[model samples]
Target: MAGTGGVSPSQTPTLPTQPGAMTPGRIGCAEIVRDLAWEHTPLGPRDRWDPAVTATVELVLTSPMPMAFCFGDRFVLIYNDAYADLIGTLHPAAMGRPAADSFGELWRSPGIGGVVEDVFRSGQPFLEPETQLTVVRAEGTRPEQAFFTRGHSLVRDSHGTIAGVLTVAAETTQVTRRLQNLSELTSRLAAALTVDDVARVVLGYAMASFDVDLCMFAVDDGNGFRAVRRIRGEMLDEADERLPPVWKRLSDDPHAPLVASARANRPSFVPDGEPLRAVASDRHERRIRALAVLPLRTASLKGSLSIGYRAAHTWLPAERALLNAAAQLVAQAAERARRFEAQHGTAQLLQRSMLPEHLPELERFRIAARYDVGVDGNAAGGDFYDAFRLADGRLAMVLGDVAGHDVRAAAVMGQVRAALRALALTEPDPPGVLAGLDRLVTSLGAESRNEEIFVTVVYGVLDPADGTITLASAGHPPPVLRRAGLGGEPPTAELVKVPPGAPLGLGGRWQTGLVRLEPGDSILMFSDGVVERRGRALNDGLDALVAVAAGASSGDPRNLCSLATTAVPGPTDDDVAVLAVERAVALSRSATMLVAAEPTGPSRVRQWMTTWLREWTVPEPVISSAILCTSELTTNALLHAGTPAQVHIDLNAVRLLVSVADTGTRGSVIRAHTDTMSSRGRGLGLIEELSDSWGTDPSVRGSTVWFELLLRSTSD
Candidate 1:
């Protein structure tokens, strides 16, 4: 009889009973099998074994492949040396034992156990292209996952009776690991929302997955393709490592591999550097031996992705497929980002056109406004702010938010803002203005077939004469007030308790709240985005805004607006608009002069101030003191600060205030002692003696020195 591989049964060798009794030439597991005592095994002594069984065992042990034979009913395990290495620590002792006892959990696994049983029962050969199993490769260590392609065939005895099953396995763990990495790349590409984002994800995946020496991504840049290349060991040239890789503009060489691939919408592979060196455009490309250029094709985008290795590499079919799939994913993401960018640009342009280009300037009140879009800059939000002069000389300020983040919402906001201005011209009162806006919004909603058009607005009118702001809210957050301290008290900030009414499109009555603002007091009105943060309560955000506003050192409306807009940390998910108005001290007259840095600057300022004060009629003594103080301040600013200064003079009912501000590195104002007799330092001395109150206000860049004189009752 002949065994499975044609070895004759008559050729079977006798088994050895004593150790080292086998042929000295046998190596590996062959030596171990020959020296084993077979009497204790299920098959009994080797001398009593069937001739066919002995022949099959000899064939398995002599083979170089990882092969195993399970004999008899218990399926006693017998394997070659290659099989011993495959099972790691489970070998040696596993010899002469049942297959189930040797493999442990691996033998009981669904794929392995069921297939082995089927092959044994049907006497058929079966093959599994790939199957996953977990095994302990070392003693006292955790089991690790492994993948393999296995083939199982039934073995026949000498009388042609079906016996046990034989198995052959080839590990495929490396290929399976690469496929897993490709799956991860697919997931990351789906989340990319911008062109630059897609490039970063693709290049990073190529570098990590392929271990390539160079990775490059190119995108259509109107005139040509612009490429961002990442090279190993080149990170030191980047100032910020967190930023995306450096970019280069490719020349208009159609012969270059990347350009050719993109133009033809195909992929090109170079297995050696000889061909690449002829068309190489740069030093990096010149040294690369293996390269792959894959075109990224999309309806709105034209680009290419390329990877290179320093040593020659054969591009396998599987690797080519994976690279092509990556390119397709990148192209889809790039298309989406292109569309978003186009829409976002148009929407933002439209939104800005609806807002006031410049705020109306008021003598007694300074106004400033700020606007910022949300983190998802793909859509246009509804927050808006404006300041315009009313017919009655009162300043009208409004900040409102429409409900949605689309073109329709932006259009409605424009309509509301234009209507607000018209209404304020006719009905200047806060309540009346809001009532008219409510009617307008309700009518708009009805026109849209009641699609739930929601809007919230806070409107205020400032009476410059009395320094009072009448405010009205329609389902909006209350305005915050930073009250200027009086009588040596620190400034305080608090939210105005305005009555909240129903939002627009819902019929409700609105009431006006009046808050009297003292000189230097500022009021801030903003959309809800200024006081709302993710993962935090609304009240906590509101309190944080109050703290930021109060902590500001200056009452300038511009500074307050800046601080309030940045009150919330991290990215904001909604639009923010802040409008700030500050009431200056009651001034009958004010004039400002830009003092030159030359020596003649102080004299010119003196002449200007003297002429202006005298023109107001009969203030000779006050005029002399004001001119002398002004000259001294201007001189000090030019000599010590080494910069031009601004001289501002304000005349009010009770006093005259003169301030000199300079933009320089110096942050403090010099104050000379009262008893100092040196002429060089007598400037501050004269200012101290002549003025009623003198002080210095330090700023971020420089300082402001000012002196006030209490006017006699006749000066006005």
Candidate 2:
């Protein structure tokens, strides 16, 4: 019989009935049983250890947990079921093998053997909380998946001491991916705006939402849905329009079930199908093997939202609800932009009607004008210009810009322009005109009950006789002028700055200044839009306009006006209006002076008119038709030309020519007639037939026939 503490050197090998059981004659039985099993064994089959204990131990040896035993200094290990499975049926042969003998590779692992030895020597249960290890097979196969986990001690000896280690763990490969998917979905939802943006976000969310291979979003019109967003990994390629139908499919036939389902605002599911499977056969290129479409409806617009997966996928009710919520947010933003566009159309119509049609003709100046509205939809700006004849024979020209860009500003602009025109006609001078304009503005403010609005303007009255213009500026940019010269080219347009005054409705005394408009000088009045552009400073925009006007041709008023407006390339970002005035050129030397003439015979009138031209420095043959036209005019003066029978010629150094004028009271009129043989009325009619331009003023004593002919300077 073997003693509990140490088997007595038994002559005959007699096995004890129970190893750790208390028997009367057992040696060290109480101590051995107390330390090993921790309980005394009874004298029955229930208390006694079973004969199958060795086999059970052998079964436990093949478990996945590492199993080993240490008695004194020796280490004995039996590979567990998982380890034996790794070795594949060689486990029984590996029974009782030492750690060094069976797993020579594990023995060479840095510090592992030493850790086990320290556990054995120290008698303290050893634990390895975490470790990283590499396993190399003697057969030189490729490395297997590495593992990370912890191991603890198992004690099995008479004395309490560390005898073995056991460990249990789980792999983290799948869990890491779940966290990444969650992180990606959170990032995309933060900044989505448009339908396209939502679709892109949905593509990323759906792919990561269920951890699928790929995801796509498609939008549908009435018929069928087309893929608008397709994502695979991190790359997003813009959709190609030139691809074949199979490449980007949307069923053309309206009768298709998918199309009908989407049009009805119902979710349609497309699983493995007869045609769909064939169409989506390619795994990498195709977006998904399964699809779901939801119709999006908000107000008048209708579209579809689609979600798909490359793998055979099934979506939960929760997933469908999440997608539907995201779709609604996307639809709301799109509808807002649409409403903004519709309102902008109405505002533009009102803005266009408020602007003036034409500029009134000043006495000795040629005026050109243009007005351009902005293209920024629905929002109207307050920019206006008007030129019209005043009651006092002076031409009143007004240009202004309201402070804001809105329909209200446009309405205010119209009221201001109309009131200014009326007031300018009634007011005595520029200051009085502005003072009346201020009262109108204050009255408008009171009518609208709006306190946060104001306007800037430049008002002027041009007297072409002296070629002097009186003007006042109220918080407006100064006009520019390009003066003409006889021998030299036109000088750079000078900026005609005025002292800033309070804007309209802000009570302040306004001062007026007079500008001398020499014969060929050009005057430009414009709103701030021409000199304040986006990405450019006010000074830079002004400088650029000056340069443009320097090179621009002062031709027809309409063309010059167009050039000035186009000179500042927009999007001006604001409304623009410009008015230009230049002196008209003279026709001939005699037309530059006011003279007297009387009719006697055809030769005498011609010679008198000819000698008058000579005195005015006119060459002989140069006045050929002019001479005949003068004879006709003199005959008409004696016959029909009314009181103050004098010819007035206006020298327009701007166009380098003259305009002829006369004052005729009554009974003198020029009518268009094709008959050439008429005698008694031929004189006045003949003047009209030969001149470049001719007109009559019945309100004055006589009328004037103005013709434009080339004036050759002596230097030329």
Candidate 3:
């Protein structure tokens, strides 16, 4: 309401005329006092209105607060500009209306009218420190419940009797809702597990709970900072390119809010929100006006969480304390989750290491080896297979099964395998290797005092120069021979009969059996578990195995192993190991090139490899990879071993197998993880990255580093 410089003498309220005749100073009060219906009130009319009633109405209308005056039996009402804002859609229509009609629902709710009535009857004031009331608001699309502290005073009329109640109130809705939301957030974050799970839960809840425009959590996983963000309850890509400013600021500023919080181990409140606005989206940069970062700390980890506000938000002491405490809990949960994952992974790695790393292959034969654990546990048992070329360039393969299936069995398996390898390098024949291994197992039993730690194995020696296999069995299953197709005869398989000699650790000397395999002939060596079923007889299981192999594609060892798995459709108690190799009757043209183990060895090897691949018309991609593998392996042998090296290249119908024999016994294929590795160590890593499959077999002379790549069958 606009006011004159001062009320003129002529315009002063001096007459006892009609209500409109006297101009009230306030707009809402003037409109109410001048209404024609006011003459019907207990006070009669504006001309007869009590001087005290007029004074209270003037106090309400002129005051800058959410105040309303109620007087007489009807409790007539009047409010100021501040109260009009609170009334929202119930404004002008509610003016000059009764208190009951002015605040219809609020009056009826919690019997607020009763408080006013009681204050009207008594001369004392009625006060409620803070209470909840649902009322319509401009900010809300519907009615919103809020907390308000209200006070009501009794006002008398012209006769000095009790008139009505005068109300003064303040809303505390935002503060009250915040406490409730924090409690809910604390409850939900309790069950979060992984970092991703924590981010999904916390970001979704924090944005809505704190009523912020954005929420982000950055975790330090010992490597680097990784952040997860949610904007108004919607997740954004953690690595979103548009958020470079935020990432850069966090990285560059040592004293930044989040950085400071982490360093000081406390929360940093940025009331101005300049830091947030500077990095926020263009639309929200102007909208968000405050930011805060809380340090997340646990026994093993420390991190930071940030929040941005779209409206002016002052961080309360209670709010800060709540977030800090909750973040500590979140940090503990995240730390435990990571620890559990690391421990579980370590256990799995230990179990997997007991199995073969990679199967060895040669041009005269392709090798396939597979070891499957028992149905009861993921831990590998004592079943093991190995195919390694001897120092003399002849291949020696072994399929062994140690009795029992526990940790002790696995330990003995390793010992027996080491003894067999050592014996193969010295003993010239398969029978000699078996006899030597038996004596070694007896000595191992004497040392361990575990007589039950016996082992059964089928040992064979293959001469690549000629097609011959010297085989011996020590109570192990006999080898299944898939005969070569010759002179229009279809291929057939027969179990190679050999004496089932006493198992190792029992002082038995096994005899050898020699087989001159024709071209296209193959041998399948496996542990007894492969053909031993729960209910079927051993002979029946063997027949089933042959049938499965017949139906399977004999293209590679992997295929044979996969077909072997189909033989036991149901669960089996024991672990299984299957090794398949195709015999070469008529050999292909092969080349052996020796490169001096010097600084130029790798370069010379690569040049020769390129020439050989071009002569064979190899694919360009394969040729490039071959050249790279050859250089890496050759360079590693020269730089690390300081011994002469040899490269044997064999290309046939189905595979391209390259063997780089080095005098270095320690050089093997590198694992994917390359931490704390030297130059040669990383070179081994490069071979792993470039080759399809590669391995190293330590011989008495040195080690043979080899890799194999599959080629289409028609390439044969």
Candidate 4:
């Protein structure tokens, strides 16, 4: 007989019995037990078995919980239907076998066989709150981790001796895995900064965690709800894939699951396809059999998240709780993003409104400017660029930066810009204009009683008649000059050596440096942001700018401005402002003709071009090609622009440039393949094939399409 030490008395089983009550059921594990040849095993025939063993077997077979009873010293197994399911494929055959034979190495593992042996020998009752086991759930699959809480109780025979041990188990694998996934989700959501980033994280987690076929994230966009949907299978067509993710809009329809869930501020689940099919308006939605919609309710944002399955499923309580928790995280992130975007938009709008809306359009020179905020665009920086005509008809351009990133800095910039323009109206020289700004900044600092007001500016004035530009600096970076090559020499770029004065507000002397620009020459002025990288030296950034500007193929002011802004490789911590002015080629002779909007426009332009070229003693080959290119441009302007076109021709010693300008809203010219049969789209192709160089310049009102033909070599 086994002693009852090292066991809890409460966990002992009550083995009640009735005489001759060993009737086996017709179905389930009971029938399998009655049919097994027990005479081959240690327990012998069923009729010969002890009454206690029979009673325990009956209890194990009838109980709903997963229970198995080990009888005698060999620990032969007798389990119910639920226990058979717990062991997966080791059923029927494992019914009457020893526990070691059925569980194999698992039975010999620590705490499993030892606990059963202890309970059987000592009559002790043991309980394990949670135990992890590697189990092969199917016949030919690898083992996977399973968690369970199991209890073992001793069973006694009719002679009042412990005969076997009975065990019960409850699996907790699903709950354990879900909690771990939730923890990981929380960590990932913490790093999400933007609304789109949050959506991507949430959608990926839901799809992987729930093993769903489809997931969608929808946000309320004032007018309606915009949704970003992802599917696991090839349910969407190629055309749908090309469209943006926010293409679908869910209105305030009560029938829509997302809208209804958001309106009621709760989650909605449908286990069967019939209910979903009745309200399904999209073909994609009709294919789903199960769906769960979780509403995201936040102070500033209203949205909903949904998961779908192609097979019917029951929405378990644990799954629902996890989904709701994920939605809460998403809502919080979205609210934060919404607030940040709102502030960023307001700051950008304020800064842009204070800057000049348009640059003065000069006839002999072209001007272009660009401004970019820092990578972290949460605040408005004090970087500004302006180009205006002075009272003496000289173009005045300034690029400056104040030392702050706030509304106050922007306000001060606006003041400095306005004061510079007012002073330039009277004092057109670059040095005088900067001197007046220095005093204004000093006065501004004194009025505010703050000595932190710092400003750096590089002001310039361009005289179009002599192509001379005068530049002055107030502790700002020197301007770059891209001098066009003459007589077969390549263009060269260098930083202007202007005397650096103390920054404004400190009161220092300012001096000017003058440079004469030739035809196709350009001067670029920029704030320090353009030449200041986060970790690199300022000289290195300056050298990189010179290289990029010199290597640029086009001398167009807009192109140069764009190249200067992107001269640095990495992100910049400050705002950038670049202003570029290019001196047009000196024309020996120029002619302009405003062609009518009639069908005879191309013919008339061709006749005008040929007559002018002939009178100028131009070669017949040049005249023929120019006439053909001009006719193509004129026809395109009329066909596409649907407006009158101005044909302008400029003749220099080296090249002849002809341009067709229109007042229409067509802002770009697209080149197409030259098809002889096509009448309308082959104009640009002819220009490209016939001219030595061709380009287009898009402006505020219209576009200029021009082509240049080299009449003589640079040696001429």
Q: TM-score for each prediction?
A: 0.56, 0.39, 0.43, 0.58
Summarize candidate 3's per-residue lDDT along 574-628 as a digit string, tens digits. 8788888877543554678899967877888888888887898877777787777
The sequence of per-residue lDDT tens digits that candidate 4 reaches over residues 648-702 is: 8877555677889887744345444454423344566677677766666543345
lDDT for 232 in candidate 3 is 66
Whole-model lDDT values for every prediction = 0.73, 0.52, 0.64, 0.74
Candidate 2, residue 48: Cα displacement in angstroms equals 77
Which tens-of-lDDT digit does each residue in 597-690 have in candidate 1? Answer: 8999999999899877777663677878888998988987877677899998877555677889887634345444545343235677788788
Q: 680-712 in candidate 2: lDDT tens per residue?
A: 445545555654434432221233443433344
* Model 1, backbone clash pairs (residues 3+ apart or across chains), number: 0
How big is the positional error of residue 259 in model 3, measured in Å on the Cα after superposition? 8.6
Clashes of each: 0, 21, 1, 0
TM-score winner between candidates 2 and 4: 4
Considering lDDT, where higher is better, how would the candidates rank from best to worst? Answer: 4, 1, 3, 2
Q: What is the lDDT of residue 125 in candidate 3?
A: 67
Q: Look at candidate 2 and tell me the lDDT of residue 414.
A: 88
- Model 4 worst lDDT window (10 residues): 13-22
